[model samples]
Target chain A: MQLEEQTITIDGQKIPFQSGQTIMDAALAAKIYIPHLCYHPEFKPHGSCRLCTVMVNGRYESACTMPSVAGQEILNNTKELNENRRALTQMLFVEGNHICPGCPKTGNCQLQAVAYYVGMLSSHYQHFYPYRDLDPSHPDYVVDFNRCILCELCVRASRDVDKKNIFAISGRGIKAHLIINSPSGKLEDTDFAVGDKAAFVCPVGAILRKRTRYTTPIGERLYDKQSIRIVGDSQQLHAGATKYGRK
Target chain B: MIESLEGKRGVPRNRPPFPVTQGYLNKPTVVNNVETFALAARIAVYGGDGFAALGTKQSKGTKLLSISGDCLRPGIYEFPFGVSVREVLEACNAQDTQAVQISGAAGTCLSAKEFDRKIAFEDVATGGSVMIFNRQRDLLEVVRNFAHFFVHESCGFCTPCRVGTSLLKNLVEKVYTNHGTADDLKDMSYISQVLKTASHCGLGQTASNHIADTLKKFPEIYHKRLLVEANFEPAFDLDSALEDARQITGRKDEMAYL
Candidate 1:
């Protein structure tokens, strides 16, 4: 898409991007990982999660939504930026119930992988230990509200691709949460099926299919096979029993 | 306000095409302050130069200040923009004033040393809300009150403001309640820096400005409250934690208490 080449320097490496592409889009297409959680290339970039915040000409802006300008100097992974990113990761960890060792999505979840990538050793801040409910009312799947990071991936995917509009984010600030659209607020009462696009977009263990919790086992999972930067969108590329369940 | 006028919660919308270009049900609109309208009518009647003849070279005209706290005259007062803070204090009969919060809870905290600073665009600018604190009032307590206000008022939209506001409040609590170490102050600087830079909107960005300003100007207020011999102390209390369980089980016995 280059009539004449346009480039932006990210952490001192010259990266070329076409018109209308964001810094995250160009960085990802160049196989350079900038550590994001809420951005999916398939859907419009929602800048909710500030995990991909980078220095753009001395100011911090989210790389996922900020359009790349040619000759702009950007710092993606500086020590200070990664330190801030780690703190943000820590906030997400403490804001909800995120017990990594027990979660079925542990080895492959993007939240866990990003935490590892940023070297977030602990929650650091005090944990809220928020009590959330589980909905196993659906015949084929379950919804665990505790593990949801409010990324809006399921909300966007269900509306935009599956056309069901089953999930929505409700509440404000620290009290914000994921909701299932139904009269009883149960999964079975809605038109959500096991094969909808929303079914595969969750990056955590919030949405799970029944009886496949340990299907792939821990060590051989998508993220376990490689670092998050390498095996980043393995879940988005294909759909199957073994997919990491992201898109 | 557009959202409020449209009968919804007043959450701010992201802008590219600003409200001037596109706003209020997608039509181009201009929103002005109430003061601006009053001044506009005066300008039309009296002409521009007559209205602008009062203040400094850069900052012109008079400002109506809604003042309160520790002042003998706790009411509205009109003054030109270039008036020194000490002059305003004297005019208001502010007795034993230690610190003057320039605007509101979100504005600058000017100590007695900075009283010579002028209230002008080129100097200490404000939106005209003034708060006077006497020497007896601990300025840190003023900040703590503001911190609590910010925590409840946060819209919880973005990550930094949603969580950082409460984090800052808790740090203030840790210090005032005597559990603070030197590290908590270090964390306050870092958290405020992130909040200032990374927030989605102005409310979140400016939430920590007063806290940062106070911490810089009045260091003794914080240092006096720190647990001197200790590097760490648990912030929350065990007894406070069990009060909910005590209420649920309906136990009044001594054994039920922590």
Candidate 2:
């Protein structure tokens, strides 16, 4: 693939990147991490999770959505940006059913790791404490609704890449739910089979490899301080791929 | 507060017999929700659509959201009505997988299955965003905690919420702690419906509705805890009976409290 070349400066560091890449892609390529949830490199950028927010020449923009332009000066990893990211992380915690105790994905989870990175120690707001459920019907995978942060990456991947069109969002706004195209609306009834990338698309432990839970020693699992790119790669990101490589 | 028609009378509880039929302060003052009054004031100030101009076409005026969680992003956001859930998340920079908690205590909990949904009262009424949680988080524990909270905070004016909430919390906690039987879950559901129908205050009535709604959507988790199968054990493990006693006595230090 012929790439369009471009140059941009992030956090005062000059970097060259392809023109078509989103600002987040360029930041990740340059190894300048800007916190984000919705934008992943392997899949198309949904830009729904706005953790990769940055300042471009003084205006706030999402690194995940903002395309690179030559000579563009971007400021990521700023204290202001970090504060915003911290606040966003806190909201996700108390909004729904997520309670991070003894969870298999605890330390290694992207949401938890990001919260630690941003230093969100306390939440002054009232807890929403929504009721959620776990979908362990899939023999190979699990879906824990409580832990879900509503980042539609899995939905997008399932539809766009997998072409399964199995997972679609239901309800509206705060009442939305993940309904399967089945009679019982359970995960077991869906078209998802073992080892499908769409089933493994969740960034949090909402989707898990069912039989593999606690089977791999804690230190050996994908989440033990290894970056997502290192632990799991784009090969498993979209459907029908199995390549996972270190960044 | 809705304009109480003139001569609207009677406090929720029976009137005190101190002055006989003469009520306290005579004029019968009415109390209203803060937001309700704010809306009333907005209607008077900007007219309907002008105030409505602040939000989406279907949802008018400003909405207050208190965001919290393990999200890559979180914070309170005020947007006009008709705002899509995606847009609200963008404004607050919320995580994608995180489910949204709707309304205040009287509202329901929403899951990711509903992300494409919009933000409107008719849609769902989460007054503000609390925190977001990831896969490592458990929804049952959160619901139990919230139920316990309502139970303790409830004024004993009514038996439904007052006693029902306390009972609901214990019942859900039993399930969470693994001691609860499948019959206990059935009893919890039955009691929840009874409270929803019979509770006097808003606190007792809808306190368990969220959990009930969740059970309706996902019954497997609740069923798994029943341990009907041979050698089946529950995943959650926090002592519910001891916790309930502690709450009742407010004495965690005493062994008798357990």
Measured against the true two-chain complex, the DockQ scores of the candidates, in the order shown, are 0.54, 0.01
Displacement of residue A59 (Cα, Å) in model 2 is 1.4
**What digit string (tens of lDDT, one per residue) describes model 2 on residues B58-91?**
5678877776666555666667766666666566
TM-score for each of the candidates = 0.89, 0.47
Give model 2's TM-score versus the native structure. Answer: 0.47
Q: After superposing candidate 1 on the true structure, give the runs of residues whose Cα lies further than 4 Å from its correct spot.
A: A1-3, A234-247, B3-9, B40-47, B51-60, B239-258
Query: Candidate 1 lDDT, tens digit per residue, B1-258?
Result: 776777754566655447898888878888888787898899999899987898899989988888899999989888988999999999989999999998888788999999999999899888889999999998889989998888877777677888888889989988998788877887787888888877777788888987889889998888899998565666667888999999999988999886
Candidate 1, what DockQ? 0.54
Docking class of 1: medium
Tens-place lDDT digits, model 1, residues A78-101: 898898888888878877899999
TM-score per model for chain B alone?
Answer: 0.90, 0.71
Model 2 C-alpha lDDT per residue in residues A57-110, reported as the tens digit of each score? 776666776778888889877776776666556656655565666677764577
**How accurate locally is residue A75 in candidate 2, as Cα lDDT from 0 to 100?**
82
lDDT accuracy of residue B186 in candidate 2: 64
How far residue A191's Cα lies from its native spot in candidate 1, in Å, is 1.3
